[model samples]
Target: MIIFVYDNSFEGLLTAIYEAYYTDIKPRAIVSDEYYEPNLIDNRIYIESDITKSNKVYEAIKKKISQDALRHVYHVFLSELKEAPTVIYKYLLIAFRMGYQVDFLLTNQHVLNMHKISKKVSREKHRMLGLTRFQLIKEDFYYAPIEPDYHIIGLLAPHFANRMADQHWMIHDVKRGAAAVYDKKEWFLTEVDMKLQASVGAEEELYQELWKTYFKSISISERRNPKLQKNFMPTRYWKFLTEKKQS
Candidate 1:
């Protein structure tokens, strides 16, 4: 068995695929360095990320496949599943062989799995858009913290950019140690350890309390169903919601 190890970046994964195709050496597995475990029976091949090779592969795919197929490639990459790299490899192999119609090939297990994972990622992105709550901090910047199940800050950036076009805001992914910042015009993503002092502004605290009170006032306790509430807003996200957080 042959295993290919990459730097665990989307570009690196594409570069590995390029190398595999050019060398005519099909790998049994394609994994990132952090996830790789040494095995005596399997020969390991480490692939260095090359922008030229990655771009070549990307352009080739764009020309050979439909633009919608290209979007699926990016969405699947953002899915962040452990098996994503290998799954993308297999899915693309079938896509390139079958052309644009590969998407409708639901009977193919690889195609079906990729579609499912991408849909899960899309749902998480949609939930974050609706559930995200911003709090005004001392420096006049709005900060919203989230712990999403997937790395979806990039997916969430454009929506907030349009919604908060006049404000400087950040949507931080606390679990991933990364954030997407929008400064009234453009947006960028960064990775930094946040040393947030629990020094929330007094006005912010007042608004939070008001919002909590409003939430309480709107609730009809007699008709409340916890299971239905959970279905709409999962319990895992309660930690960051202003209304759900313990006072």
Candidate 2:
């Protein structure tokens, strides 16, 4: 049994496929850097990430699978689910064995599992965009912090740009050390260090006060139930939700 290992990145996964096929050996397992076993007795191959090889695999997938199928697979890859990588690999293994019909993903149990996981991930990405509340800063740049479980920075960038087109703003994914900045006509993604906004001093506290007041006024104490609030606005997420934190 041959075991192939590569870096734990999407590009690395694709490049590993290129090496796997080139070696013309059936791989017993495809493992990532995070799961490398030090004491391996099998015929193990270590693969480096190569953009060219990754591109070739992408091209092959596109040729065999429909564009929509590829997108679904990418979404599943981005789901941040613990089993996503393995499930995607199984889907690919089956796709290679069966020719170009990735739509069978709709029916295959393993593929279907990925579809569900991906959908959940995408839903969370969209929800965070709606829930994120930005504070207008001194530089006229709107900013917000989110610690999403997935790499959703690229996905949530568009909503703010479209809704507040005339404003300069940024939606930072603090967990990922990245942000999407938008001007009226253009947007760019940037990487920044993980640090709190240095300028958010006593003045920034005003927004917290206002948000807390608004939350209290809106809350119908007669009908308020902690259980209901917990269901939608989880306590785990309250740290970044200024209003929730204030209340």
Candidate 3:
């Protein structure tokens, strides 16, 4: 069995698939280099991020699956879930096997996992949309920070761009060390050092104070259930979530 390994980027994954089809060895699995563990007899192919080959795979997927499906795939990839790459590989394999008919991915296990991941990622994306109140910095650029479990800044830029078209905004995904910036017309993502001390929103303290008050006010002394709340909002997520912090 063959193993195709690539960097974690979406383009890198595509290039691996491109190589998989062109290679003589049949693949038992296609996964990221981070997940790669060499075997005694298995064939291993290390695929690099090649723009030309990646573009070819990209175009093929675009042609086969609608733009909407591709977008959904992007969100699922950004989920950073352990099985993300495998799920994408399965979807791509089915797409190749079934041709255009693979577009009906809802029934397929691989595609369904992608859908489930997308929905989870999207719910977090939307939650951050309202929960992430931006801070006004100098130069009229609105800056906000989010440490989402997934890389969802690009997935969310269009909404803010449409809502605040006249203004410039940047949403930094602290966990991924990337930020999405939108200047009136176009949008793009960039990598940045999260280590640098970022200035806080002038109103951040006030909102935080208010957020605490609200959290306190919402409780019913007779009905409080810490166990249920923990089950719903795991403690690990509290660090980045504004509303999830302690009073």
lDDT per residue as tens, model 3, 1-247: 7778788878887787788776665577777777777879778878889989988878877887657567666777788766777677777777766765665657767878877887898888777676666766545666677776777777777778889889777676767766666667655666544343434554556444433432332332332221106645556556656576566
Which pairs in model 2 have colliding backbones? none
RMSD (CA, Å), candidate 3 to true, equals 11.6
Can you write out model 2's per-residue Cα lDDT over 15-54, one digit (the tens) per residue?
8877776767767667776777667577777889999998
- lDDT per residue for candidate 1 within 1-247, as digits (tens), equals 9999999887898999898878988999788887888979989999999999999888878888777777677788877777888888888888888888999999989999888888888888898888999987544567788999988888898889898899877777878876677657667676535433345565556445433432342243433211108877999999789999766
Span of 10 residues, lowest total lDDT, candidate 3: 219-228
* Candidate 3 ranges beyond 4 A from true positions: 39-41, 103-107, 196-247
Residue pairs clashing, model 3: none
Q: lDDT score, residue 154, model 1?
A: 86
Residue 155's lDDT within candidate 1 is 84
**Model 2 quality (TM-score):** 0.73
Query: lDDT of candidate 3 vs native?
Result: 0.68
Which candidate leads the pack in TM-score?
1
Off by more than 4 A, model 1: 195-228
